[model samples]
Target: MASRRHPLATFFHLFFRVSAILTYLCCDWFSSSFVGCFVTVLLLLSLDFWSVKNVTGRVLAGLRWWNQIDEDGKSHWIFEARKVPASNMAATEAEARIFWLGLIICPMIWIVFFFSTLFSLKLKWLALVIAGISLQAANLYGYILCKMGGDGDISRVTSSFLPQTVFQTACPDDFQKPGLEGLEIHQH
Candidate 1:
């Protein structure tokens, strides 16, 4: 069965995505906007939001599928030029190259960035490092918040989308609690 969309969650997702991009580009006043965007994207990417739960489920499912593979066989993947179509072979090769390159180069890229930051004596680079550290901290906070549920979010402090109505004041019944001593409610 498919999950029903929560109206509030949908609104926040759209708001966050657009806010993140704007935060990155709106550096006219404060340069910290870029840092905010970095944190937001990192959090959004890592968090298993409803939109991404399928992706997480697929990953877990894929791992389970892989475990079923027979590891005892002496096997090799031989791509026959005659059997496979040229376009498909080319596409497969391109995707394979990308996967292999990501596997090899991502760590190296991080290592290079690490050493460059570590050995650098420049003030500008140090500022960038500080921004990155702030982003990581924000991401960690976001993940913790996600785990705890979205009833409370630090984004509400920075976001303009938070509810600010005085309807509860006008309609007091919505805000009032019933007396538990005399209360007996139907459990439907």
Candidate 2:
């Protein structure tokens, strides 16, 4: 069977991905003022980050992340994974692939621009290039975490610096209560 995504998920996935590239080009190629272009690209990058992290990610792949502060003022990162198992997660997998692929490609484009500016000694564009790369890297990190089951368990560890938890309250297979075997209820 083929995997499929909701129409909106498909829309936003393409929108955010294409917008990132277009915004970068517009700021770099069309805008006359360096400061103005930098600010515009920064704003667009921020919008992409928020939309991907909050809206499209949840709608398409059912994943999200947030941070919490403890009494000691230490920060803990939490990743929430919807319990859609692999067997039944074909659609989610497809959506995740789109999200991840876009994230990967977007950063590469920025990296190219970064090098082009560096070699040409166009130091004015330095800040904008770095900021774009940083934002894309952050998005990539979240995508990786989502793929790793969001439990901070990418590998076995004997010790850890940060605390993590995986709450599995929404497993699709465990949603129903078991009853007497062979018992059935009928309604009129």
Candidate 3:
């Protein structure tokens, strides 16, 4: 069941890892929220890939995935996995762009929010909340940018998480979200 691992998750794990490390060299205050995103990305990378050989091992693997793996070890009891060609350069670049954006944007937003407190406590709460919300938006933009082919990945993740289809059904990317810099998921 080599199906559970998502390419995006693995990629993001590396990203968050590097970003967390860079938090020391590149910036200051590697805060709890930073750790939270790092941990979430790590958990995603630990998705149970079911490349088992024995029946017992297979069962154990399936059990680890909450019985998500099939007897044939295909699905691995995780979310639907799309097996894009390992050589898909375009998709790879698209994913990199999104991930890099998150790597850059997430920390910057957190840093600003982290320092917004010297002025006032209310600003601290406001900054942290705004930073968290921005992380969600950054995640959505990166995910959608990664998903931008065959009307599948970008639109699908966008619709699932920060879905704008309900409010801006007519917009191509539903890129009309009020607060976003630009809801347009600019594909690489």
RMSD of each: 23.5, 10.8, 17.3
Candidate 2 lDDT tens digits, 10-50: 67766765676687676657767877777777887887778
Winning model by lDDT:
2
Residue lDDT tens for model 1, 1-188: 22322334333433433343344334335655555645554454234233222222112111000112247864332111112234343323333222223222323433444457678753344443344334433432332233223224457532421121123223434553222222111111
TM-score per prediction, in order, is 0.27, 0.70, 0.25
Candidate that would win on TM-score: 2
lDDT ranking from best candidate downward: 2, 3, 1
Q: On a 0 to 100 scale, what is the lDDT of residue 96 in model 2?
A: 51
Runs off by more than 4 Å, candidate 3:
1-87, 122-188
Which pairs clash inside model 3?
1-50, 68-77, 69-76, 69-77, 147-153, 147-154
- The sequence of per-residue lDDT tens digits that candidate 3 reaches over residues 1-188 is 13323364544434443443344233324455755544543333222111211111112111111224567776431211133344443333334333334433444555554556435564424433354445444433433443342133554555564444333323434343222121222212
lDDT of 1: 0.33
Error of 1 at 111 (Å): 1.0
C-alpha-based local distance difference test score of model 2: 0.63
